[model samples]
Every structure is written in structure tokens, then in C-alpha cells.
Target: MTDKSTSAPSSDSVSHRVADTSPESDRGEQPETIHEDRLWCDGGWTARVIKNEDDDGWAVEMIKDGEPEPALVGPWTMGRNKKDPKPLDVSAFNTLVKTASEVLRRHEQQLRAQLHKRVAVDAATGDGQWEITLDIVPDDDEPYALLTAIDAFGEQLAQVQVAASFKLSKASAASWVENGFRRPG
Candidate 1:
């Protein structure tokens, strides 16, 4: 029999072999599973244990598939010997994926909040309250916003394009309604 240590295939080779036989390969998709001492790739995320720049300790970075940057990075535990990092495991990798997914979710929520605004004001016509919303489009060439007015029944009354810098507030919405939905100056 051959010596296992000397004849063992590298993780990269093993990964390719696994992918070649996987169903995804039939459709030209890359294999998404990898388990290594310092690296774990699965479930649309990859967790890598790396050396910390500020200290002698270790850090783990979680990167979503197709993303250029890691979504989360934090300290990692040391192994029993204290000189080497703790080997990555299934549980630890799953936890890292959860935390990284949460980070991405919060980031998306914050971005949506920044780009959308809403205010409710009494209609100048004395008909009823109207919900005014501003949705900003952050285009590189022509950044703008769409100001919309909706009645209490959820029917849209008006929509106008405005500068992206337009501020949405109760007073401003009231002014717009009072001006008969004319484009805000």
C-alpha cells in the first residue's frame, strides 16, 4: 500500500474531483462545498481563518459568494497549543455565516431607509390626509427622486420627478399639496 501522507491529494485537487462528479457540473456550475482546517466554503458563503494584523491572534472573515469583500471579520480562538488557530468546523462556519448574513441584511435596510422617505399631511383641499413619499434614484449621471402622493385609500394621486436632494417633511408635503401638486421648486 502507498503511504497515505505522501500520496494524499491536496484539498484543491479533492475539491475539483468532487465538483467534477457533482450534478452542478453537468450544468456548468461550480461546486459549492469545501471543508478545510482553515477554510470553509458552502451555503453561498466562505469562511476563512487568517492571521490578525494587529496581534498574534487569529481572525475569521466571512465572504458571500460573488462579493469582492468580506461581510464580517472577527477574532478567532486559539487551538489547544495556543500557537496555531483553532481549525474551522461546521458549527463555527455556520455561526459565521449567520452573523455575516445579518450584517448584509442590516446594511440593505439602512440603504433603503436612506433612499426612501414618507410623510403624512392634511390635504390642502380639506379632503383627507395624504401620504407623500420620496424615492431617490442614485444614478451616476442623473440622480433624481420621484415624489408621489397617495390618498388614504392607497390610490396614487400624483407623481413628479424632483432633484434627489429634495427633502421630504410634513411641512414640505403640505406645501406641495397646497400648490396643487406642482413640482417643488
Candidate 2:
């Protein structure tokens, strides 16, 4: 019952979509499923996730808002087995949210990896060791990373860039730390 402009796919350009796919990849994003749930968004396009009613096939709807629409509607596959949808609990919801967030993060990572490059380093020698993976910062040539090194007894060691891919092994890293982390020529 929502407007079409807010729920349908734009027709400005052509796109390619596959008919069959692995179960997890669908996420209720089928052409028909898009139309059923009143799945409307912002750009005069809406998608609906059809709910199972009376044992009927799943479906979706995608139409523009407020235009006596029905521009795009089709059949869709069920996302989860109604026979066992795993009861929705606070813990389950929390876990679902966490998983969803991680999925988004991985997607973002893939995008970044496509645009950036990385290198792995493992510098080690007896009595000294360092290990780190470094990143070649995009648009810049400086190599930065999280560096970890320890002297034999696991003494407090120099640490940095834990959030990045910077790595260095023992010998050189120890020397660098001992020398106050001077940029190596």
C-alpha cells in the first residue's frame, strides 16, 4: 500500500541477474520476493518479501510509490524454513545483529581490498623476533602496520598499528625498537 517511487528498481539502466544461486546469497532478494513485502525504499522503487500464506510459493514485489502500481511482482524462495525458523530471542537477535554487522564489515573489506594492496612480513632471528603484516596505504607509498616483537623472555615489546597490517619479525624489529624506531633506510 506504500508509494511506488519509494520501492521499485530504477529503469534507467540495464542490469544482469542470475536465476539460480546458493541459498545464503538470496537473503530474500529475489525478483518476486522484492515485490511482496511492500519493500519500498527511497528511489521510486519498492521491494516486498512475500510471506508464506496457505502454503503458497514465496514472492516479492517491486513497484513505484503512489501510482496505482504493480509494475514488478514475482515469485521468490523462502529464506528460512518455517518448519524451524529458530525461535527469536534476545540472544538470537543479538547474535543475528552481530552476524549482520560482520557481513557488512566483510563486504566493506572486500571493497577496500579491491582498491588497496597488502604485504606480509615475518622478520625473525635467534634471541630476537618480530612479525607483522603491512599495508601500502592507498594513494600513498608509506608502509604502515601493527608490529610485535619480543626478546627471549617475552619481555614487554614495542607494539604499534594493531589495527593495520604492519608486521616485523624479531632481529630487525628488535634492533629498530632498541634504536628508538628510527625509519629504516
Q: What are the per-residue Cα lDDT tens digits for candidate 1 across 1-185?
A: 11234235334322211234667767856545777767777778888888899999989999998899999999999866586777777788888998999999999999999999999999666888889999999999999999999998899999999999999999999999989999999
After the best TM-score superposition of candidate 2, give how far the Cα of residue 151 lies from its true spot, in angstroms: 5.3
Q: Candidate 1 — which residues are off by over 4 angstroms?
A: 1-23, 27-30, 125-127
Clash-forming residue pairs, model 1: none
Per-model tally of clashing residue pairs = 0, 46
Candidate 2 total steric clashes: 46
Candidate 2 overall lDDT versus native = 0.42
Candidate 2 local lDDT, 21-71, one digit each (tens): 557447854332121123323233444445446465655544444647544
Tell me how candidate 1 scores on lDDT. 0.84
Query: Which sections of candidate 2 miss by over 4 Å?
Result: 1-36, 40-102, 108-125, 133-156, 159-181
TM-scores, all models, native as reference: 0.86, 0.26
Candidate that scores best on TM-score: 1
Local accuracy by lDDT, each model: 0.84, 0.42
